[model samples]
Target chain A: MSDRLAMEDRRSSRLPFPAELGALVAMALAGLLGYLVFPDDLAFLTRLIGIVFLVLSLDLVTGYCGIATLGQSAIFGVAAYAVGNACLAGLVDPVALLGVGMVAGAVMGLASGVLVAKFQGLPQLVLSIAVGQLVAAMANKLSSVTGGSDGLAGISPGPVLGIFNFDLYGRTGYVFSLVVLVIVFVILLRFVRSPFGLLCRAIKDDSLRARMIGARVYPRLILMYGISGAVAGIGGALTAINTGVVGLDSVSFERSAETLVMLVIGGAGTLWGALIGSVVFQIFEHYVSAANPFHWMTILGLMLIVVVLFAPRGLVPLAVSVVDRIAPRLGGKS
Target chain B: MAWTVLGVVLDAISYGMVLFIISIGLSIMMGLMRVVNLAHGAFAMIGGYLASYALKSLGVSYPLAIILAVIGAILISIPFEFLLYRRIYRKSDELTQILLTIGITFVIIGVANYALGPTSKSIPLPAALSGPFDLGFRMIPAHRLFVIACGLCTALLLWLLIDRTEFGVRMRAAVDNGDMAEALGIRTQLIFTAAFALAIGLAAFGGVVGAELLPIEPFYALRYMVTFLVVVSVGGAGSIAGALSASMLLGLADTTGKYLAPEYGEFFFYLAVILAVFLFPNGLLGRKH
Candidate 1:
């Protein structure tokens, strides 16, 4: 995985500041800008951040690790419901709830990863979908615990770090989610650049070769999937906190499919691509669906087709190229 | 108890036949082209909508409606093949193929909903088939028998086509090795187009015939996508016999599971799928890479 990307990484490393720091700064600026721009829609922005986490986790497995998963929502939904139930059972502390969510997500991720890591290609894809559907079915059938199709509601999470109570305007929630997003993004930036991440990439590029060379491919894949699940779980926990509800749709096939669409639209295999893709897709959808609710799917479909035809690498890379063309000095920075 | 058991078996067989019919096209396409065409269900939905349109709006006869739906769907799919699908065939990325097809599915869904309203469409059966048929043990819907006959006929015809016909020989050769088939002057592109058309046609036929079991709505494509994919994958992507057996096995699991425990019906169906896929990672009869 990093073999194809090592050149770009080295070039960016020569820049004045580290690429990761720049991305963190950029995310902070964007989060603040979004806050100022959409004060009324903070709820939506918070949800978008949660989705950004979902897409990032998806990138870890699908984009970086070369796993084709359409069932990532299982991890996300599992953590979310876990947090929701924990809240209902009197674990209202937002930070602790997030921790609970991560554990739940990692457990579910590892459980599914055990089976999913065994296959590759189309079978792998089908297996992931099966796992996702199985989780969803369980969620639906165990209505007594999960609240089933009706969803778990009334989950009013306590304030951020025992201060900044979650208000109706969602100002606190928005800021809290942004802070967590930045933290997760920074950690993930380091995570992907680490030797372990590179090994995962090498395995993704050719597991048989990696295995021949003495790499324990299965454990690495399973571990990466577990980490990915934790990330997705945090996102789910955020959703549960922000909206005070965890519906069956959280674990639905559609949710998983939509997450994939967001990842692809952003461009897979890159963290910035994941973040940019989810944010752009969410904002684009926010406006487009608002304007033409009936034809939103058609518009989105056309946009996706256009992207596949012309910008197969996704919007982030596409934007990067245009910026590079305009400013030769900035070309190497990205 | 025996009568109920017999009823469940009969319903499961008919339902499985419907699954076989709808999913075989997807199975063949996935096996032959390795395209992962999620839009396959969109074609089926289009066929159902067209058949319903012909039945209610045009007041066409039942058989005529089915014929019109199949032809119309094929015609509708030809452009997609040439313009969109042709470009996609060159790409090796499974993600790209999946995304493109999903985009196509969304477009079809949006258009269907916008043009045909969100309400479900029913293909009112002809009087002859609408009534129940008497067997020695039980009276079953005549439509089930009709669907079963259609499914069996499709199986026999497909076997004859693949095993006996020149076209089938070329198709098998292409599936076995596309480059080798092309080297032998088989015109693999033309073969693919024809096969694609055949797949779309079969999907239309299934959509119209199986509409009683799986209703035709704008969201039909996305709703039953997993089910179809499950059958094709379980049966083995390219193997007709694999698909037939998988469909029947899944069909039995789904029906009996529902009978045994209504709430856990989907659970048993998916559980069976996981176990089957686990047991046969390449599918029960899929070719080893």
Candidate 2:
């Protein structure tokens, strides 16, 4: 790494912790403190964790992998149905449901990857939209299984890991989600830092160059897409278990667009952005909706316009700039 | 069975005709400017609404409404092309284009949803256009025949304009090589403005022609824009013949699905689309520029 990176790393570690570690600690402590102080806030945190996982999944493919997709919500919707279906069948085992979701999601990802990896530009975007609409239609058509527009419910995930009981407040769900988020983040950190990750970024930067350099772009992209699907599936499954409800929102265009916005706001290609971006955007969404349900889209739309026009680099880039400015003032760097 | 099949086939053709109108312009834009306008549907909606107003307020015939709507769309799109699209014409990255279009789509959708209530409305088809025409095999809606006629005439007009006319030649030349066309004193700006206007006029005309089949509602344009643009993708962007072929194919597929099995219908069609795109990644008629 360059000296600037080293100094940034050192700066990240100044508080006797690595950056992600520090962030995780801060979150856990905040969660614990909120549990003690607010108590009711734990459920919200759990939902936030679930939302964060979604943002993370989006970041994995879109931000880090550089694959601009519009159909991830389809995979999320599929996983949700899987989880809810398994639950309705009395298989309330979270682990098994998550695994099933992951497998189904991975399969969809691979299928979509084949379609998308070879295509570029308008065709790809159109295909992605088609994927989302197709899934929505499937879910709508198989109303007998998916419960159609009414959505699936009556899911009582009695306990998580058979140790922590799912209480009235969903404390177990919250903590379980937090643990999963941390574990997934660690895996994703390792994955993105790997050679495959480098190749994906290279493909993103200059696909022609990556191809000329023998990157075997399609297979790598397929792998990345599969992982993204798996992550999205996990997020979906967790959402089903936590809320005890699964609906058409999983495969919605609005959800896909929201996740895209979250990935941008948080900082694409950075793991931390997923977590922070999801939390921040969800809160913003809740507030915007509360202000005016029908017109909130206008606000979110304006934000999207602003970000693309002015802050195309996203929140992470803004953060990096601020840190850069502060470093010299703190006598840390030139 | 034959009656329904014949009816559905006509319905499909009409649907395809509308998609052809909307996408031909989009395909042309993609060919000439290499810019994907996600807001093409908005222009279509504007046409539909304007036509509806003309029919309701002025008591104008459907054909007159369509003409007025097309004119309105042309006038509207020229300004948009000059202000927004002209700036982003040279950016090579699709992602940037995607973002710009998405932003424009959002703003338009918002404004439309705000201004136009969410309730769906339909343009009044005159008795002449609404009549059930007697085909030798079965009866078909007159409006359906009209849309098909409109599509055929537009295709012929476009071909002649591009291949036979000086303006069309200049437009095609500009599409192929913008710099060269500019250097040759082709007055590229006027050509671009005219192309933009013509492209949107087609969308508006389609909007009025096909308004009865698909009702105009808030954000209605944006909802089906992607599906329509798939024609441009399938047929070949900038290739008029390609747009026609793709629209007809997609229209037939959609009609067959809705007719045969409404429940499992859309599912089957999209599955085919996914498969088709996988096999032909650039689209059915895609050619490297």
DockQ of all predictions against the true structure, Cα-based: 0.78, 0.52
Proportion of native contacts kept per candidate: 0.70, 0.55
**Top-TM-score candidate index:** 1
Which parts of model 1 are misplaced by more than 4 Å?
Answer: A1-17, A329-334
Instruction: Write model 1 residue lDDT over B1-289, tens digit each, in one string.
Output: 9989988998899999999998899888888888788898899999999999999999999999999999999999999999888876534678888888899999999999999999999999999999999887668899999999999999999989999999999999999988999999999889888888988999999999999999999999999888998898898998889988998999999999999998864888889999999999989989865
The DockQ score of candidate 2 comes to 0.52
Interface alpha-carbon RMSD, every candidate: 1.1, 2.2
What tens digits encode model 1's per-residue C-alpha lDDT throughout A1-334?
Answer: 3454677578667874376778789989999999999989999999999999999999999988899988999999999999999999999899999999999999988988888888887888889999999899999999988998899989998878888899999999999999999999988988897889988888878888989999998888899999999999999999999999999999999999999998888898889899999998999899989987659999888888888888888989889878877897666577
TM-scores for the candidates: 0.97, 0.91
Number of the top-ranking candidate, with lDDT as the measure:
1
Candidate 2 has an interface RMSD (Å) of 2.2
